[model samples]
Target: MKLSRLGPVGEEVPVVWEEDRAFDLRPLTADIDGAFLSSDPVAQVRVALADRRLPMVGEADALRVGAPIVRPSAVYCIGMNYAAHAAESGSAPPEHMVMFMKSPNTVVGPNDDVAVPRGSTKTDWEVELGIVIGARASYLESAADARLHIAGYVVANDLSERDWQIAVSGGQWSKGKSGPGFCPLGPALVTPDEIDASDLRLRSWVNGEPRQDSRTSDLIFGIEQIVWELSQYLILEPGDLILTGTPEGVALSGRFPYLTPGDIVELEIEGLGRQRQTVVAG
Candidate 1:
């Protein structure tokens, strides 16, 4: 079943999305966070649905959609995992995965407005497939082991500001990446059983024009490998979010102009759902 949170920010209640309507998920759990996911909630949701214990949500479409999961303890990102994206950014694919972090607080609802940081002229957009961790793991022995810890998948917009990332900040990327609503996630939190992440279409647009159009198959590093490798260096806590990297077709490539206030940015990943955000002044 598809899971989501709706209502005002920080007041979102969990719900399950079916074909025609949403079913209230609060009867099963208060929120879809680390604690709820670690309990093997999918099976529990199935049982709840079988018993008709969930009530249909009223006017769900009118409510705001929050990030499917709560603010994670950490938000990790893999950089240049797509070879074409690496080339566009003027680099060769690394022999080992490159990683970085975005402040967890940067996350916001899928359709919320995103602000271009003040005095910035190079805000860009990246569409990426996101992995949500369901179990804690450290020093995982293999990719198979890492796979067992996954909760599900999501669509993510990894917004960046080229100036802070490259011209300043001593070569650190997060400086440009941690602005308010820099990470807009969700519309749905798809369970693993409902999708195959190995290869899926990923696309993005700016103001109704197609920008990035690529596939997860182009990824140099897959999800399992990413998680397994990360476990070796640090702990992967439940509900942690990992952005699997974006494909080519961003403003950073210089083929397109950077985002400015009043621009509408849209991103999508097959099966995971879509996100649309309006650019606003910070």
Candidate 2:
């Protein structure tokens, strides 16, 4: 099922979205997050759905959709995971995985407005696959074990401000990446059974023109490898978000202009869903 949350920000109600219909998730859990995911709630949702215990959400068509999952505990990101994207930014693919993080608060609804930090001159866009952790993962020994800890996938826009991420901070990336609304996620949290992550068409747009067009197949480090490697280093708790990295075609590549107020940014991944956000001044 496509698990979603809709309504005003912070007042969102959980629901199971299937095609044109939405069913309330309140009967099972108050929210879709760390607690719910860890409990293997998909089985519970399936049972409730089978028994027709889920009621149709009211006025579902007009409700604002929030990020499918609640704010995660951490937003870990891999850098240089896409070879072409790495080369475009003047770097080589790493021999060892390179990772960084954005403050969890940076996450916002997929369609929410993205605020360009004041005085920013090089804000950019990236379309990526986001992994949502389902259970505690520590010292995982293999990809098979890592796979079991994943709750689902979502489309993520790993928005960046090159000026802050590179020009200052003496090389730390989170400084430029932690602006409010930097990580726009969701539309829905698709269960692992619903989609395949190995290869999906990942795309992005600015205003109405195409910018990034690539596939998850181009990832220098695949999904299972990313999760297993991360597990060896940090304790991944339920609901932690891991952005596997983005493909080429960002303003940072210098093939296009940086985002400005009023620019519309759209990102999508096959079978997962899409995200549309407007760029606004901070």
Best by lDDT: 1
* Candidate models: Cα lDDT each: 0.93, 0.92
Candidates in order: C-alpha RMSD to true structure: 0.8, 0.8
Estimate the TM-score of every prediction: 0.98, 0.98
lDDT of 2: 0.92
lDDT of 1 by residue, 1-282 (tens): 689999998899899887858999988889999999999988999899989999988999999999999999999999999999999999999999999999999989999999999999999999999999999989999998977899999999999988998899697889988988899999888989899998999999999999999999889999899999999999999999999999999999989999998999999998888899999999
Give the clash count for each candidate.
0, 0
Q: Which ten residues in a row have the lowest lDDT in candidate 2?
A: 169-178
Clashing pairs in 1: none
Write model 2 residue lDDT over 56-173, tens digit each, in one string: 9978978888889999999999998999999998998889999999999988899999999988998889899999999999999897888899999999999888989999958799
Q: What shift in Å separates residue 89 of candidate 2 from its native position after superposition?
A: 0.5
